[model samples]
Target: MTRATFEIEITPNETPLLPGVGRFDFQKVWEGDMQGRSVGLMLSAGDPASGTAGYVCMEVFEGTVDGKLGTLAFQQLGTMDGGNQGLRYIIVPGSGTGELEGAIGVLNLTVDEGTGEHSILLEMSSDH
Candidate 1:
C-alpha cells in the first residue's frame, strides 16, 4: 500500500431541510502535490449543543492521487457520541476512474491545530 498526502480546503453551505436537520453542500479544493477539486453533499442531524449527532456524505473527487490522474468517489460516515467522535472515510468500491481504476483504499484526514490546515492521507493499492 502507498500513501498520498495533500492539503485540502472545504467551503460548506448549509440549508435547513427540516427541524433539527440540515443539508450541506461542500466545495473542496486540494493542493500541495495533489491538485483537484471535489463536490460533496451531506445530511446532518442535530445541532452542536446536542452533544450527539451524525452525518453521512458522498463526495466525488476529480483529481490526481499521488500524481496519477483520475477520479474517485468517497463515502464518509461520521458521528459524535457525547464528547467523543468517530468518523470514517473510504473510497467507494469500483469507483475509481481512468488510471485510478482498480484502486482500493481508505482516506484519512487530519487538521493542523495551529494553522487549521487540512490534509488527506490516502492509502491505496497500486494500479498505476
Candidate 2:
C-alpha cells in the first residue's frame, strides 16, 4: 500500500441543483508518494449554518503513483453535524485507466482547523 498526501482548492460553481443546496468544483494537487492533480465536483445539502450538512463528490485524478502514470476515479461521501464530521473516499471499481488499471484504494481527508488547509491521505494499491 502507498500513502499519499494532497492539498485541495475548492470553488463554488454557479450551477444550482436545488434550493438550499450547493455545487462546487475542486482541484487537488497531490504530493508525497503520488504526484498529480485531480478535478472533481461536489454536491452538498442540508444546513451548513447550523453545522449540519452532507455531501457527495466524484473526482477523476490524473497523475503518477509510485512512478506509474495513469488516471483513477473516486467517489466521496461525507457528513457534518455540529462539531462532529465523517468522510470517506472510495476508488471507483474498474475506473482506473492507463498504468493505474485495476487500481484499488481508500482515501481519508483531514482539515487543519487553524489554517483551514485541506489534506488527504490516500491508501492505494494496484492489481495490475
Candidate 3:
C-alpha cells in the first residue's frame, strides 16, 4: 500500500473537554484540495502517544467548519488515510443518525505518498 506521511501541529483554542490538553502532534493523510473548491483540508488525529491523552482522531473539513459566520456543511467522506494506534472512524453529512451528534473528538488521517509540510485545521461544530 502507498503510504502518505505528514507533520501535523494542532493549537488548542479550548480545553473545556480536556484540561491538560496542549499542542499535540499527528501524522496525517494529504488528500490535496479538490479542484474548483473554495477551501481544502486533510484528515488527521490519533490516541495518546506517550503524553497526549484523547480518543481517535476523525474529521472532514474545507477551510473552516465553523466560524464567526453561519451554518456550513462539511461533507465527510467515509474513506481517507493516515493515523497511528490502528483505529478507524468517520463523519458523514446529515442528522437524525447516531454519529452526527454534538460529541466531538480528534480525526486521524493518512494518504498514499504524502509527507509532512502539508497542513489543515480541524474545527468543531454541531450537527444541527
For residue 124, model 3's alpha carbon misses the true position, in angstroms, by: 22
Give one digit per residue, the lDDT tens place, for model 3 in 1-128. 11222334454434244444333223233333311122223333333344322333333333213222222223333322334234343334342123334524333454434543433333344545
Over the stretch 52-113, how does candidate 1's per-residue lDDT look in tens digits? 88999999989887788899899999888778988899889899998889888888887788
Error of 1 at 10 (Å): 5.9
TM-score for each prediction?
0.82, 0.88, 0.30
* Better candidate by lDDT, 1 or 3: 1
Give me the displacement of residue 56 in model 2, in angstroms. Answer: 0.4
Task: Give each model's whole-structure lDDT.
Answer: 0.78, 0.87, 0.33
Off by over 4 Å in 3: 1-9, 18-53, 56-60, 63-84, 93-108, 111-114, 117-128
Worst 10 residues of 2 by lDDT: 118-127
Worst 10 residues of 1 by lDDT: 1-10
* Residue-level lDDT tens digits of model 2 in 1-128: 56666788899999868998899999999887788999999999999889999999999999988889999999999999987989888889899998899989897777788987666677777766
For model 1, the stretches where C-alpha displacement exceeds 4 angstroms are 1-18, 126-128
Ranking by TM-score: 2, 1, 3
User: What's the distance in Å from true for residue 86, model 3?
Assistant: 2.1
* Over 4 Å off, model 2: none
In candidate 3, how many Å is residue 103 off? 20
